[model samples]
Structure formats: structure tokens, C-alpha cells
Target: MTAKKELLGSLLFAWGANSYGQLGLGHKEDVLLPVRVTQGLASIGNIKCLVGGGGHSAIITDDRTIWTCGSNAFGQLGLPQHLGESTLPLPIKTLNGKAVEIAAGLRHALAVTAEKGLVFQWGVGMKSLANRGLQTLPVPAFMSAREPCEVPGFGHVKVKHVSAGAYHSACITDQGWLFVWGSNKYGQLLSSDDFLPLPFFIQPHHFEGEKITLVRSGWTHIVARTERGQVYTWGRADYGQLGRKIKSTQDSMCKSNVIQSRFTPEKVPELTGASQITCGSEHSLAAVGDSILSWGWNEHGMCGDGTEVNISEPRQISFFRNYIPAAIGTGAGHSMVLCRSAGQSGGDFKACPEEQAVCQGNPETATT
Candidate 1:
């Protein structure tokens, strides 16, 4: 009997801000169009996870190894600080064949190991002034670590997923419990305290009897999805990062006058049956049913509205109406979707319809 050949590697396409070569395209030029990343990931095996930070990116393969590229400033790429940066995907020997999930923040990164489920963190630590106006009262810095260090706690529980915001981090255990740490300047941790240097449980009561299955963080906000497909968000809302409207009296002078931030999690009424959720620096995206919805900061058209206006409410991205998103991701100023053609099958890749619309009749620029 002949053995079946194992399929190696998967196609990855990236676009948007590449000022630091975060797209792994072997160059530092911005990609206005989705381009396949083939420079350094040709033999890594099927990709398990992909994430991007402010100016860096990371990928996890089926072998459970990590490959990183782009800015390594502050050592966010899991490489030696001296290496500085790389435009090609380089294996992170420290986490070889151990990591199951990974997440990237603006200046830091986190990973969950497969064996003990221990969480590892690297890059710059979070810090914020207690009172910006009073330099003497400034909060102490959290101390940066260039190499991976096991995040204290979670020794007994097995973490299944991890997430990182610009300065905060979070993880969900196999038991469906959520723990968060780092900056709470905007109450992202659901605490009155300013900063949490160590991980702390979010309390089961806050979830209202429903276990959280997944969580994602923006620069200053968090969004979580329950086992029942219900979505909740909290933290900063001045930019409408929170999907729900802040409670306020009808007689309020104006929208700006009302307190927009939510210290605790609240249901996102506009989203239902969310299968996947991701957060950018100050924006969010979700795959619901067959469509994708986006909200929050849209200064760079990341919301897919083709406008630079900030989106205050969850709106369907018309550009993807004809496609069924299999997975969705967001960056500080960009968004990406991986989907198959509507009628095509058997692992065939389908280029974004918008890409086709823009490149049509231009043979040299066709994505497929």
C-alpha cells in the first residue's frame, strides 16, 4: 500500500502597513494589495496561527514551532535583541515544537506552551504614570525582558489560548476561565487598580454563568465570546472601541459629554453568533454567520467602508458580502480575511474579490 503524501505549508497573504517589513514580503514597502508571503515560509508546514504586532509578526506552524520577522526592537520577535530586525521568517529556537498559540501586542508578545500550558512573555513591560501632571508620583516601570520568561501563576491550570493588547495580556484556560494582567489605565482589566503586574482571574460571576471560550484585546479594550456565541466588550470607549453604547441620561449635553468607557464587560447587541473575533489597536472585527462585521477606529479604512470615518456601530463590510470568511484578523491599521471561493473546493485558494475588482484587466497585478 502506498502512503499518502502529507501536504506541507499553507498560503498566506498580507497587506497594509509594512513600514517595518511586518508583512514578511522581503521588503519594507507598504502593500496596498494583498500579496502572497513566500519569501521565508515555504517549508514551515501548515500554519496554525498568525499574528502581527505594531511592526512585527509571528507565525505558528503545525509542528508547534514559532517563526518571527519584522521589528525586533525591544525583542518582541523572540530573537536576540542584537539581531535587531529581520524581514524573513526566522525560527524561534526558544519555543521550538512547544507553543500551541501565540499573540502579539504593540511592544510585547506572549505564548502558551502545549505541555504544561505555561505562559511565556517577552519584550518591553507595561508602564504608565499614576498622575501625568505630577512627575514625582509617576508609577514605576514594569521592567522589560528581552527573552521569554514564564508568566507567574497558571502553574496548575492548562491555558488553551492567549492574547495581548498594546500593553496588556490575557489568557483563557482549558476550564474556560479568563485571567488578565498589565495596564488597566482604561479599566481593561475590569479593576479600579491602575496596573496589574501579575495575572489575576476575572471572576466567574462577571461572565454571568457563561464560560468564556475566546478573548481578544485592542490597545485599550477587550472583547470576549462565550460558549453560547454571545459577545461582550469592555474598557475604553472614547473612540467607540466598546461596541455597545455607554449608559447615560437622555438629557446629556452631547455624546462627548457622556462617559463612554465601560469598566465591566457588556454584551455587544449588534453582534450575534460570532464564530471568530479579533481586535486591532482600537478597532474590532468578527465573523458572524456568512458575513463579517467591523467597528471602532477606521481612520485608515480598516473597517472596510472605504472611508476614513470612525465607525461607532457594528456594520457589515460590503466588500466581503460575496465571500464567506473562514478566518479574520486585524492589525493597528489593516484587516485580512482568509476564505475559499464560494463554489470552489478542496483547499483551493481564492483571492479577495476586491483585489480582483481592482486588478482586473491588469495581468501583471492579478492576485491569483
Candidate 2:
């Protein structure tokens, strides 16, 4: 009679702009409400994903280990060296546990390794402030790894998923192909080469054949999702974040009509079936079916629609309607929703100003 291994924890909750503490909730302020986050993440057993970057926050758990927290400056929390900031949650241990999938950006961070998926990357690489016309400022064209290296040529290329925006990085090859590398500025790596540096596949007739299972990144924009559920999108359409709409093209070298910025990929017919998708820094989210759909840069509401205004297309949030989402996250402004109560089994996290504030718990007592 020896059977009792049901751990599987949950219940993490966090809120908008945690300054540099990145909401691990130990300090650095800015949370605005929903807090929990349990210090350095209790014992770290269940959380399989929760990434929020720009200030930093990783966590990958399920024992595959990763757990970072708040700005390591340019090292992007791969840890080691001088240790700039960490509002708690440490554990990088050289990714020995195997880290399944991870992504974070605006400083940089990426991972993916469960044996052959092998990806890993580290901070600071940007450069291409929109072809240097943003009027200056945007340096560090390379600093790739301060710690967890291994992003060579993909060895044999197994990578399942990986994304990091603001600066750039992407992966997705289990067969679905997709690749991509750093900073194409607003084109988000559809590549006119503002700064590609390495990994660059992205061509299966521009996804018209349908394969990519999922992909996400924003700060510049990109939202993939195809296996039939459709959804495409491409980089920085000003503030509308490419949720569809931005199509003025007559500039055969400036004959005149040029609104540009999407650069390539389009689709997003309203996010087709969207099972789940995320991005923030400019805003984007999708869950569909039970409903969750949002669009670009809602000022500070992060597209919750209570109106800070930006949203160009999608829109359906109405507070999750009744709750069923399961998981979805985004940062750089804030948005997180791990739901449950449709019939109830216990799980509800929510964030992003759905009014007064709610962060209830009980993921089986929030294990430790």
C-alpha cells in the first residue's frame, strides 16, 4: 500500500507593473491588487509556466525547474555573476532539471530543453529602434548569454516552443518549423534584417500550409497559432498591435501610399478558434469558445476593455464571462487569468483590473 503522490500545485496570482520585483511579490511595489505569489514560490512543484518580462519573472516548474524573478539587468536572470535584482524566487541551477519551455523579453530570456528540445538564450541584444528613426536610443546589439548558453545551431532542432519579444527570439520546431531571431525592430523578424543575428527559418509559404501549433510575443508584435485554429498576426502595427487592420500599400519605393508595420503574416480573422494565446507589452490575448479575446495596447487596462482605449479588433473579455480559461498570461502592462469556476473545482486567479480586485486561492491548499 504505497500510493500518495498527488501534489500538482497551483494558486500563484500577481498584478500589474511590479517595478523590478516583477511581481514575485516580495517587494518593489506597483502591484495594485491581486497579490499572493507565495514568496519564493513555496517548494516549487507544479507551476508549469508563467512568464512575464520587461522587468523579469519566469517560473517554469513541474520540477523541470527554472524559477527566476525580477530584472537581472542584462543577464535576464539566468543568474550567477554579480546578481543585480531578485525579489525572491531564485533557482536557475544551470537548468539541470531540464526546463521545458520558457520565454520572457524586454531584457531577454528564453529556454526550452527536455532533453532534445535544446534552446536556451540570455539577455540584451536589441538594436533597430525602427531602423534608427525613432530618433536615437536603442543600443546593445549583442550580449547574448551571461549564463545559460547553448543556442548554437539547434543541434538537430527539436524545440517545441519559445518566444521573447521586446528584443526578439523565437522557436517552434517540433516539425511546425518557425525559427526567427532578434530585433527586426517593428517587423518582428519577418526579416529585412535590421538585426537577425542567427536562427531564421520562417517560411512555409508564410504559414499558408498551416502547421505552427502556437507562438506568442509582443513588445513589437507576433501571435501565431495554427493547426487549423488559424490566427496569424505580425509585428508592430503602431499601437493596434496587428490584430488585423493596417493595409495601405502603394509605395513601390514611395509612389506614396504607405502605412506599413505589419511587414508580413496576416490572418487573425478574429482569432479563429484560438485555444489560448498571449502577449503583452502592447496587448493581445485569446482563449475563445468560452471567451477571453482582447486586442492591442489598452492603455493600462491591458485590454480588459473597461477602457483605457487602444484595442483595434478582437474584444470579448467581459470578465471571462463565467470562468473557464485555465491559463493565460501577459506582461509589460499586466494580464493573467487562470480560471475554473464554471461548475467549480477550485482555481481562480484573475488580474488586470476586473474591478476592485480578486485573487482567491486553494489550489488544493496551495501546496508547499
lDDT values, one for every candidate: 0.69, 0.67
Evaluated against the true structure, the overall lDDT of model 2 is 0.67
Residue 325 lDDT in candidate 2: 64
Across 44-137, the per-residue lDDT of candidate 1 in tens digits comes to 5666566777788877765778888788877888887447778778888875238877888888888888778888888874543223322465
Candidate 2 per-residue lDDT, tens place, 135-190, comes to 35443333446567767678876877788888777877767788887667577777
In candidate 1, which residue ranges exceed 4 Å CA deviation? 1-11, 32-43, 127-143, 251-257, 347-368
TM-scores across all candidates?
0.82, 0.34
> How many residue pairs clash in each candidate at the backbone level?
0, 0
Model 2 segments beyond 4 Å from truth? Answer: 1-91, 94-102, 105-142, 146-163, 166-182, 185-216, 219-241, 247-256, 261-277, 280-290, 294-322, 329-338, 351-368
RMSD of 2: 18.1
